[model samples]
Target: MSLSFELTQSIAIIGGGPGGYEAALAAAQLGAEVTLVERAGVGGAAVISDVVPSKSLIATADAAVAIAEATDLGVQFFARGGDGRPLRPQVAINLAAVNKRLLALAHQQSEDMRAALVAAGVRIIDGHGRLEGDHAVVVSTGPGGTDFDRIEADTLVVSVGASPRELPAARPDGERILTWTQLYDMRALPEHLIVVGSGVTGAEFAGAYMNLGAKVTLVSSRERVLPGEDPDAATVLEGVFTRGGMTVLSRSRAEKVERSGDGVTVTLADGRTVEGSHCLLAVGSIPNTRGIGLEEAGVQMTDSGHIRVNRVARTSVPNIYAAGDCTTFVPLASVASMQGRTAVFHALGDEVMPLDRLRITANIFTAPEIATVGWQEKDVTDGVADGIVHKLPLAVNARAKMMGVRDGFVKLIARRGSGTVIGGVIVAPRASELIYPIAIAVDRRLTVDQVSRVFAVYPSLTSSVADAARAMHNVGRVAEA
Candidate 1:
């Protein structure tokens, strides 16, 4: 619904990423004058360097993986050798071509977003933007950044995203030692990649490179990869990593990364060293919220430098709002877009649905993706949520057998008595897509029986979702009886 106000309101946004882009579009649609200031491109890091490009690389890697897995599905390829003996075809990746394609995809997406914002009547300024106060923004524009433009608005939105967290001892040189953003510059795959973190980012790249035919060594500080995610899912991924010939050094922390002769050496805190042609640091990220005049404007900020915002994406100051990684909210591009719209709606006096962090769906894009929404099995076990869990392995599903999918499962959690779906996890090929129906169930508070009643396409992976919901129904009844 379009929000109508007595007077045309002006909204000035800093950082033209997902959050800022969405806010500008939404505000413009609601009859507000919107001005978006971005130092990078329109889609910000999410499109230009991070999500779009990274996912594209993963897609190429997946294609390579699929070709290898195809042989198991009765597919065969052969080539004649010089000795007249048939040779099995091997899959290989053109790193330079893959990087070029993904970068082009990112650039095109940024351009599309820019065109959309312009068509929506949003005024976009390409430069560095900072808040002058709660009601105005100052942007440094021009070739040399010597020009300045001030935009006065009734409300302000800050969506400055975050950057990969860098450590003092392992500074990225954009060559041997690199950050995630610097990955595309490599013309060829590294002979061996040492990933210094076992979180989502680390595990993802490690798996991707390994699948792309590169020797990968994952150095994890935790006992398992994806320590913060569901344990069962992590176990499956770790098992896959080991089976795929990728070395996983668990409970090992990288203390320093030094450039060695024609390679890099990662020194562990335990005095162990691993040498690799390249190193990728995926420790975490820090919000890009500094030097933005946020403190001067009296906005509340966390000790970690993230903006403190309420459910509606509002800052301590009423008219000022923040979203994306800059705010204390789930740092996902989808969540950022939602928060942006919610902020604009709340500011325009329109009815708004405050974001519920629990309902946010997150996915880890490994070979077999791990996706989760709402509460988890740990939440139930930790007594944080009153729920019962039901897990159904994909091995039992007909589709999984036909596709040679040996790993992964669907786990559902529901309220004890009412059987209302509260959370769920899916570890499967493209679990990201399969988890959406479950996310809807969580959002609507649908009971297990209710979900079981919904028909899923037969002989599809989604059938596992319905099957789990149906099984949960029986468990709920048994518990009640």
Candidate 2:
């Protein structure tokens, strides 16, 4: 089906991540000529160096962990030892093959995104796009390089995304001290990986490497791992990581990282040092807001250098908008895409949905993923919400039991008076997929009773969600009685 629009304005989108690409498609589909400027491939850092590649690597690591657990399910392996002793079970990984597969998947995603954009009639300019004026941009090949050309647009969409934050004292060499983006280039697993930071990215890499047969040490400046996540879920993950042979150092800040011959040493702020074969710095990301002429064009930015945009993704300047990690909103691919689409919709005079942070669902892709949507339990505990919390453990679920999942649970928060489901948390395998139902409920403002009435498949992991909803209903009844 072809979409028709009466507007004849052209839009320029800088960056090619989910936000930039999705906005480009939306604008083009709405009959606006779109030009997408990208320094890298079509899918930006999320597809090329970060999300897709990291997740693909995790997929192989997950398979290895599954094989290790197969013995418990009566799957035995026999291996003849070189020393004449029979080895009952052994698990091995070809790091080269795994890296190849990971890169292959990342490339496939990039190609798919390119094809989609091309088919949608969005012109992709291979260069760094910077705003030359309030209504124009110059695409450059490199820093201080020749200006390829300039394009003027009626509207501009800034989705410049972000880069790994590097400390001056702990600069990554991409060998011993590495950034998260550099991990994809490694063909061999580290003997021991020391991951600095306990945020989502740091915890995920630390967990993935540990599962892939590498001893992992996670250093956190906070009191606990995943300090920003739900406290209960964080506690559960911390326990799981410890049981999985991960050394988690809390309240430790990495002040410096330096190469020590073949290995690396990370110094803590408290005069302690940890040595490992490799060090992965996952401190955070810095928004790609510099040298974009944002200040000259009146685009307001936060103190941290993230672009400040309104609910419709509009910058302080009327004709300019921003989205993705470059904005002050949560750095999530899903949220970025929504912000991009919303920007395009508003620019084209279409119906625009205001950004709703409460409806956004986010996941930390650990061994047992932690997915959360809507309000958090801490909000209720802190009297930030007029709600009650209900939790159901996966150990009580039939499917979880069959799948040998002893850890993990689903927790739901509902409004005390209306029983309206406000938020939920799922800590289990494939929690990313399982959180969608809760996301939909939160987005549509569905009640707990409405969620409980839905017929979830019997003996499925999702039954835990339904059970949690049902528990909420029962608790409501007890409160009224």
Candidate 3:
């Protein structure tokens, strides 16, 4: 069925992240005249600075680790030096080349987005778009220059995204003190890297750099690293990081950072200081909600500065909508895209599904990716679930054993009385891909028995998921009197 919207009304989208661009495309496809305004390149942080570049670097690091593991598969190596030390794994990274590839991929993605929008008849404007008044926008072009223009639209979608939060006392100079966004600019590898923040971004970068052959120290203010992630998953990752030579300093909050001659020093809250070749501040992200006329337009904002939006992405102001990292929703590319599409659908007076936080799936791309969907154990403890929990260790899986994976597991949670799968977690290689079936099951409200009946390969990694489901099959039986 062809979906149609009012052809006369014009739609304007601010920001060019997955949320913004995907909404623009959907709006245009729905037959609305759309104009997309972006200050940075089209692909946003995911394609340009943060996700893509970091994963590419991780790919290189993974390759090096793989070569080191080849000896277990009976690959013999010879020493190339006079000292007879097996050539030291001989992997050299050209930072310039890596950066070049990253930019090229980003540009290609941007171009593809632009071409798709142009082909769909969506107008593209390169500028910083800010609301001037109701249904009006002032676009500042050419970064920091006085090129300004005004445009009018019937509906507006705000998805200005986010920036890395900085410490007031330890502002990044973009040199010795750097944010995760600035890491792509470094041409030489740091001899030692001190990462401040134990969140997903911090943990990912810390593991990536450590695998890339840099001495890494992860400083966390929380009791454990990745405090927000699954407890079991976090425990396993902490052990892996420790085994891989990463110094994890829990309960250590970085109070200040200072540069001293070719290196940097991080002072902890307790007055202890650690020196390193570089410091990466992955503290958190601040939504780009300021100077966007949200408050002037009567849109409510949270105490934490995120735009207050409903499930359908509507703000306090009727005509103004918000999505992506600019709102209180979890910051993820997939969720952002869904929010953007939902915003457009609602704005155009079409049938729309409200944002389902429980259905959203997220993955942390560490050595063995951690993927989860639905309820959390902590949430369950807080009365969020009256579900039975089942866990299957990867060490028992035939594929994992053959692949030499000793650490990781699959966990599923189902309602105690109904046996309906409400949550799942996977920690293993390619866990990101393996989580999709579980996500679909959760989204569709499938029972553990229903999921277990589905066929799985005999000796595959996905068998762990099946095992977890089978383990949950007895939940209802045990719950009954």
lDDT of each: 0.94, 0.91, 0.88
Q: Score candidate 2 by TM-score against the native.
A: 0.96
What is the C-alpha lDDT profile of model 1 across 1-481, one tens digit per residue?
A: 6566789999999999999999999899899999999998999999999999999999998999889989899998899999999999778788999999999999999999999999999999999999987899999997787899999999999999999999999999999999999999999999999999999899989999999999999999999999999999999999999999999999999999999989999999999999999999999999998998999999999999999999999999999999898889999999999999999999988889999989999999998999999999999999999999999999999999999999999999999988999999999999999999999999999998999999888899999999999988665666678
Give the lDDT of residue 130 in candidate 1: 90
Assess every candidate by TM-score: 0.98, 0.96, 0.96
Q: Over the stretch 1-481, how does candidate 3's per-residue lDDT look in tens digits?
A: 3675445678888888898998999898888888899888787877788777788787777776777777776775666788765574466667667777876777788789888889999888898889976697788986584898788989888998989999998889998899988988888788999999999999999998888788999999999999999999999999999999999999999999999899999999999999999999999999988888888878889987899889998888888888889898878988889989999888887788899899999999898889999997777778878988888999999989888887899999898889998999999988899999999999999999999999999999998888889877778889995
Clashes of 3: 0
lDDT ranking, best first:
1, 2, 3
Clashing pairs counted in every model:
0, 0, 0
Best by lDDT: 1
Question: How does candidate 2 score on lDDT?
Answer: 0.91
Candidate 1 residues lying further than 4 Å off, grouped into runs, are 82-84
TM-score of 1: 0.98
Clashing pairs in 2: none
Worst 10 residues of 2 by lDDT: 1-10
Give the Å error, residue 131, model 1.
Answer: 0.6
